[model samples]
Target: MLARASAATTALTDPGDRLAELCARIAGRIVFTTSFGIEDQAISHFIMSRDLGIEIVTLDTGRLFPSTYTVWDETEQKYGRRIRAATPEAAALSALVADIGINGFYHSKDARLACCHVRKVEPLARALGGAAAWITGLRADQSGERAAVALESWDEERALIKFAPLFDWTRAEVAAFCAAEGVPVNSLHAEGFLSIGCQPCTRAVAPGEPERAGRWWWEDQGSAECGLHVGPDGRLVRDQPE
Candidate 1:
């Protein structure tokens, strides 16, 4: 399936066409994860407007901003479809918080990654269960870690095909499309919040900063990843072994 999808859609210039073909090929077996960012809104618009059957879902990390939830409601209203919610395990979260007090992630990288593993990664694993294709709103220009992203590839860990339809699109291109299409956008973008994540871990980006600079700004790591989409080498995996 991975080889076939790559060969059939790699050279396609139109994102809509690629998505259409993907939806046709996978049909009810595909899932799309959205954070309601500008890029996510664009991809959601394409899927909804084109009547694609990819299931839309989001991880409710319990630390999101109110504006994020508002945009999510707006998206459902505009698209006339409910996005599924994935939550972390109750016992694990309670244990972690109890052991480290509410914000232990600030103390060390291990704690931070552990929080991400419980809140985002584990839930995402469940959300992608039995899915043949996993759709993401990742764009190459968003960060240096994702600079070499491909349109389609295999995800060995999840055992599914990963498709990033907007892999080649720029932030400007996404914003323009969203404005023209009237897609519901996160209100924080206007305030320079180029990347939105958990409330405590995110902030507005400054001038001349990368798009994801706002996320995990307190950390001094080389990457701002949350462990959900990164490989074993601590980089965004563009190509997975088939």
Candidate 2:
């Protein structure tokens, strides 16, 4: 399944064509997780505009910026489709805050990962449950850690096929596509917040920094990820198990 999907995805040049092919080839629910970033907005436009049956969802980490929510609302309004939100379990979130305080993620890497687990990763698991294919807007040039991302691969941990239709696209290409399509995006992108995540952990990047440098900026460059795409070894999971 992985090899055939990879071959099919690689054969396609356009992202929209790849997506349409995936929809035709895959049997069950295809889930697309968006964060309202430019890449995500572009993918959302493709899926919604084409009326593709892919289920669009988002991880509402509860700590998102106002601008993020504003863009979220605008995207829904523009597409006339409600992007399903997978939120953190209230009990787990309450316990986490009680144990480590509200902003404890700033203290240690372990603390931050724990916060991310409770907020983003866990909710994502619930969102991807029963999905045959999981789609993301990830691109190769977004960060060094994600440089080896594949267009399609098997997610062994989640037991689903992972597809990054825009895996080979560049930031400039994505921005240009969004501009031409008039896809609604977060307003913070113009203010240098190239990669917007949860409010407390994200900031605007400097002129020469990588696109994802604004996310988890205080952490080591190698550890900027929030565990959504990584394995237990802290590496991006692109395994194709035999």
Candidate 3:
């Protein structure tokens, strides 16, 4: 299945075409998780504008910026479709807050990882349950950690295929596409929040800063991930070459 799926996408240059073909070739549910970022908006457009059957969903960490929510609403209105939300489990969230004092993530890296595990990784597990394929907006140029991302890969950990349709796209190209396509994007993007996430965990980048520099800026450089794409050993889950 992995070899066939990889071969099917290897020849496709257009993201929309690749997605359409993936849906046709793969059975069971295909899920796309969006964060309302510029990259995500482009993928959302490719999937929704073409009326693809892929499921669109987001992780509402309950601490997102107001602008993020605004764009989320605007994107749905523009596409005339609802993006399902997978929020943190209530009991788990409450317990985390009680254990860490709400903003304790600011104190240590471990605390932040725990917060992410509860708010993002766990919710993503629920969102991806029974999914045959998972689609993400990961671009290789976003950060050094993601520089090796592939267009299609077999996610052994999740036991499903993972697709990064825009993996090779540059930030400028993505921005241009969103502009030409008139896709609704977060207003914060223009304000230097190139990589937006939760309000407390994110900030605007300075000149010459990396796109993801804004996220988890407090942590040491090159350690800004939230455990969403990495394995238990804290390394990216890369594809095994066929």
Per-candidate clash tally: 0, 0, 0
- Model 3 gets an lDDT of 0.90
RMSD of each: 1.5, 1.3, 1.2
Please say which candidate is ahead in lDDT: 1 or 3: 3
lDDT of 2: 0.89
TM-score of each: 0.95, 0.97, 0.97
Highest-scoring model, lDDT = 3
* Residue-wise C-alpha lDDT for candidate 1, range 133-199, written one tens digit per residue: 8999988898888888888877767778888999998899899999998999999999999999999
Q: Which tens-of-lDDT digit does each residue in 161-191 have in candidate 3?
A: 8888998889999999999999999999999
Sorting all predicted structures by lDDT, with the top scorer first, yields 3, 2, 1
Cα displacement (angstroms), candidate 2, residue 25, comes to 0.7
TM-score, candidate 3, is 0.97
The lDDT of model 1 is 0.87
Reference-based lDDT, each prediction:
0.87, 0.89, 0.90
Clashing pairs in 1: none
Candidate 2 lands at a TM-score of: 0.97
